[model samples]
Target: MKFTLFSLCRRYPIWVAVLLLYAVASLVSPAMLNPDQVLNIVRVTAFLGMVATGQTIVLLTGGIDLSVAGVVTLVNILSTGLMLGDNGNIFVAMLACVAVAAIVGVTNGVLVAYFRIAPIIATLAMNSILFGVALVYTGGAPHGAAAPAFNTIAQGDILGFPASGVCWLVLSIAVAMLMRKTVFGRWIYAVGANARAAAMMGVPVRLVVVAAYTLSSMLAMCGGLLVTAYIGNPSLGIGNSFMMTSVVAVVVGGTALSGGVGGVVTTIAGALFITELNSFTNIAQASTGAQFVIQGVLIAASVVVYRLLARRPRA
Candidate 1:
């Protein structure tokens, strides 16, 4: 009973922390409770929340993608380049973006699964290569404006709430169902918990790993597209921070670095938490260094608590 309770507690620390943070923020400034401010938080948080969803999946498989930011860069470039002043060509442009994103995903998966490279090192090297590709493709500058329709997807409201936020919620529900009510979901946990044992049990470990990465890449592309719409112009390296940010959100959301745990709901909460922290800090006139210190301390504290709860006492 204690073990079960402890496990549940570790899995949900993010939600608990998020509630506390929201409560504190609300108290600190009632303006934080204003409907528009709350909407703004949800609006901005959805993009990263989607990216973190994919990140959580990969992390569940005991893998990581340091190339997500690079992938987003590539996607944004494609979106603008293909759709530039050509609304009629939108479908083709989108198809190309998806294809490229999937190809990148497959490449990463092949390297990590068949080549057996360490996830972090493999993805990091891939990121370097991707960075070079982005630079070469854009010649250090990228141009082209987002289509009005695409921008609407990112910025429009549905029933007075941000469309992207609604999309995030829908996607979150779909992913939750996938993770909790499917055999493949069970396979993910099994493989993450013990790949060797999973393989011995006849699970297709390689395929699962590949699929996880492919999904991550595709989701990242989706995020990039949204960001591209929001920004309305492509800039080189606009998404440079997303890889690390997504990883941090996933980790801080109570997802185990060791894998086979956590959910998209937690990841969404984590993204919101981080976003809120940044906004609050900015509002409070905190320096960049102070923000860093606070973030570092919060992450350290969360990890310590997670590790403590995850530890099994000797019988």
Candidate 2:
């Protein structure tokens, strides 16, 4: 069992780093050393983890989605407005939200895949468009309440577990399976590693890229909806932090910014680490601006270290 655990650690070195960080944070923040803090960490991690999963997919194809915050904000506005605290309307409202989210994803995909625009530029522009659309739809201040039933999806417990945490676990496991056990996963890796080569080998490179972007946006939508439910109302920039934090989580998880080297496990671990760090910040009474600075530093440090490790001479 010891050897087996050791082998698993060797297979996933980032997990070891995450554990170390967790231990250090726990030691520093006595509050976080308790069992309840574990659940708290999982609950918060769920929201970021969902977004990170989508970002992971896009990054795996050597692409990035800067529009996630927009998608989340838009979805949050639409879902709450449509539900209007009516449980009877939740199904329809959620369906509408998901549809709109998918359309946004498709737009991002088409721009990047068909128009040949840079992913970063395309998604950034889309982010502006989405925010504008949301503002127009809300007439500036969004006003509506999430259905009580809908709130249960994120706010309530499921079999003694936070529903959001359960959702996170399920999504993490499913995405991990998809990445490791599917043909589409192979295509993702291939295209990220080399689009031209993948296309030469008859892979539907454009389709894959589009699918990845679409999936990324939809996942962001899921996070948005859950956040809306959790928060019980509407806000314009609720998801703004997600835009950068998702990227940070993906990078901190050991994924290559250049693509082709990340998975669901890595991303979930990253999300957990980020959430844990944030909790520590709160406990330590760090300024909000300091939190952003810390995250930015983490991203830069991750990239530098990853690039350096990649450059190392192989045995």
Error of 2 at 50 (Å): 0.4
* Candidate 2 Cα misplacement greater than 4 A, ranges: 1-10, 308-315
Question: Per-residue alpha-carbon lDDT of model 1 for 1-315, expressed as tens digits?
Answer: 456744555556777787778788888877788889889888888888878888888899899988888888888888888888567767877898899889988888888888999999888998888878888988888777777777876789999999888887788768878878998888888888899999999989999899888888888888888788777788776879798789888888878778887776788888888988887787777899999899888888878877886685633
Best by TM-score: 2
- Write down the worst ten-residue block by lDDT for model 1: 1-10
lDDT of each: 0.83, 0.87
Candidates in order, TM-scores: namely 0.93, 0.94
Task: Report RMSD for candidate 1.
Answer: 2.8
Query: Judged by lDDT against the true structure, how good is candidate 1?
Result: 0.83
For model 2 the TM-score comes to 0.94
Report how far off residue 40 is in candidate 2 (Å).
Answer: 1.0
C-alpha RMSD by candidate, in order: 2.8, 2.1
